[model samples]
Target: MYHNTKLTGMVVYPNDPEYQQARMNWNPFTNAFPIVFVFAQKIEDVSNAVKWARENKVPIRMRSGRHALAKDFSQTNGGIVIDTSHMRNVTLDKKNGIAKVEAGIRVGQLVRMLAREGILAPFGDSSTVGIGGISTGGGITAIQRTAGLISDNILAVTLVDANGEVLQVNACENSDLFWAIRGGGGGNFGIITSYTFKVRTAPSKVGIFEIIWPWNQLNEVIDAWQRWAPCVDVRLGTILEAFSKANGLLHSQGIFLGPAAELEKLILPLTNTGSPIKVFVDEVTLLEAIDFWAPNEPLFDTQNTTWSSTWVKSSLPEDGIAAIRTFLERASGSESNFFFLNSGGVMNQIPPQETAFFWRNTRYYMEWDASWTDKCETQKSIKLVEQARLQLKPYITGSYVNVPDLNIKDYGQEYYGDNFERLRKVKERYDPENVFNFVQSIPPAHICDEKDIDD
Candidate 1:
């Protein structure tokens, strides 16, 4: 009964030779074993897989690039994992400044392809992260201030819902679903198979700079960066990172749409703040700037790590900066560090209630992660990340959905903020049976007494 002709595509079973490799996650900490993996090569394959899963009564999890930070974010112990890495197709409409892309394309591949046409699409730091997974959860990139989030650039999407029906969702049709999927988290409302994004023109060369200060100057650097980054010229996008004491680094790097001379002039306030060890600024190709910010190799990465993040409503005071320094000092691994992204400009032009992304008034986004290679260091690393998040809760407000953390109890509020309740209602419409439910997946709205649902 389950061998339906529509269930087409490469399927890997538990006993298959490729099953072990196919089921591997980008993050090694998320240990899971799925019954099967349906590698979707087309929209029909996605539809068929959903129908088959429904008949077989198997829970389904959506996976692409396998880079979900939270455990169980993209896989399950005894479920069907729909892996959409085979559908890498794109149609570029340069005249209209639009790019229609398949769901499985990684951020790096897409950006490079568009760069050849002199088009700049918003993308994240990692080259291997899937656009579907990240964009659906509000993709943040270095150019976010100038271009807006990846979600904001989306003009439309092709989705396969819980009922095995393919639907075209946009501002006109299925409008509510359109708003919900943008920044509401992927696989919560439906399976997005393709997206049409509004891209922008790009200069052949832009200003790029990297400045580093001694580890001891981190506190002052943090304070100076907080004041300057968020309010910098919209043409420039900035990021600062503080490595664990073991690495002894406090680096600030960014890109300016103008020449290196202009960028250098714009960043004098930061350089003049404290004693600096090294400063470099110059004109570079957009691809070169993308390569410079990349931390991991442009390939599927496997590492044991735990991550937690929150948005800053205001600048962190001296005490807050001290707390960040103290917690980061506990990290001993080379990969452990605290990262920051300046927020504002085009990303904030839309108010909170306009879309599922609610943290529009944020100053910057901050996240601290702990990494370890030794099995002996696992517990300590995870515990440190959790404790660090709790300690810094006073300084941060909302959590980032793409960078999921199971430790956050009130995840609905933490991830979606004021948009949580409306997201629940959209979940009620598209996935009323909760067929796509997971740890932090939105649940259908409950029509009951307010008292019964109070936290």
Candidate 2:
């Protein structure tokens, strides 16, 4: 491998001792071995690695937590992988309720650091997911209903552009770049090095809920959830996840923030609609609440899975719910989960045009996820996700970027909607050469469409 061994950061080849660990990401399905893995130790190391990859004419795969769903975004067959896991650093400005964190930090790492200071930032679901990817792609957290997404909390960021020069971007300086990073998906603009965010103080009391029902009742529960979940108080947010148990049974679960009594009151509608096998709700510290819903790691051990999702302006109608029910009943062919995530919390408080994330009119975001271990079974799992997507397509108006599955055929249009053009102009002004291109990259206007380009 052509590597600068004398460089400060460690370089690992396929045969290196840490190769397997370095390549192992949250998403185990990505199967690619870069010629060289640059384990960058510092900001300058990240810049140098990027410069090296550019000079070598090598395709680059940058990893921050490596939870990316698309194999193309985090894996390259024979290229350079810039591994940033070692650069985790968190500094809290308690007075300002803000935290400055390194790109390599994970949601759990940052949360723990901030909790020590009685501060909180709206990060994504998993603690292992790197903040760089999460914040850049518009992070949605359990706390989103209260403080907005992690991207919305971004007060400043130091990113390395295509030219390998670091630029400080924020609301005032490099504002366009800042907007793109908030929700435009990462790797399309630049490599984010550090993010300065406006963290919020945690609520004195946080609530938790875990409920499960029979597979047959999914339609009823979903129909009821879609009607009531979003209308819950802004102090509360709900994530309804449908999953299969180890015994080959399907289940539905979620997380909410509020007092247990109040949460139970809000959830009474579902209890009345369906017969649940398990139901538990309680209140706990905002920090302790993290483990209440799921104290253990929640990811399945499978690489080959297909997940597709979209947003809807209104709740699914009876026919829509019926279609989803049909799919859910048939979804036992593989371990699949259909989820509904309510969007209005602090997210709605911000105007749709204020940032690139344009799901304002949509009340909910939905996902059809399927996972399997065998490659041969991949087709079956994919079909389940596709069936769900097709059924919900009529109601889906837009999409979310952080789910890691950016398979929307017309990615730019679906993910960004009306904001696609503005993001493209920012892409030109910042990384004109498309140095940050990837599987779901925002292509320049001249290369894709003329009317979309901004002056």
For each candidate in turn, the TM-score is 0.96, 0.92
How would you encode candidate 1's per-residue C-alpha lDDT over 218-288 as one tens digit per residue?
89899999999999998888889999999998999898888888899999988897988889998988777
User: Which candidate number would show the highest TM-score if scored against the true structure?
Assistant: 1
In model 1, the Cα lDDT at residue 267 comes to 98
How far off is residue 213 in model 1, in Å? 1.8
- Native-referenced Cα lDDT, model 2: 0.73
The residue-level lDDT of candidate 1 at 387 comes to 85
lDDT of 2 at 413: 71
**Candidate 2 lDDT, 282-334, residue by residue in tens:** 88786777655324354334456667777778888888877766666665434
Measured with C-alpha atoms, the lDDT of residue 79 in candidate 2 is 80
Model 2 TM-score on a 0 to 1 scale: 0.92
User: In candidate 2, how many Å is residue 165 off?
Assistant: 0.7
Task: Please give the lDDT score at residue 78 for candidate 2.
Answer: 83
Considering summed lDDT, which 10 consecutive residues are worst modelled in model 2? Answer: 244-253
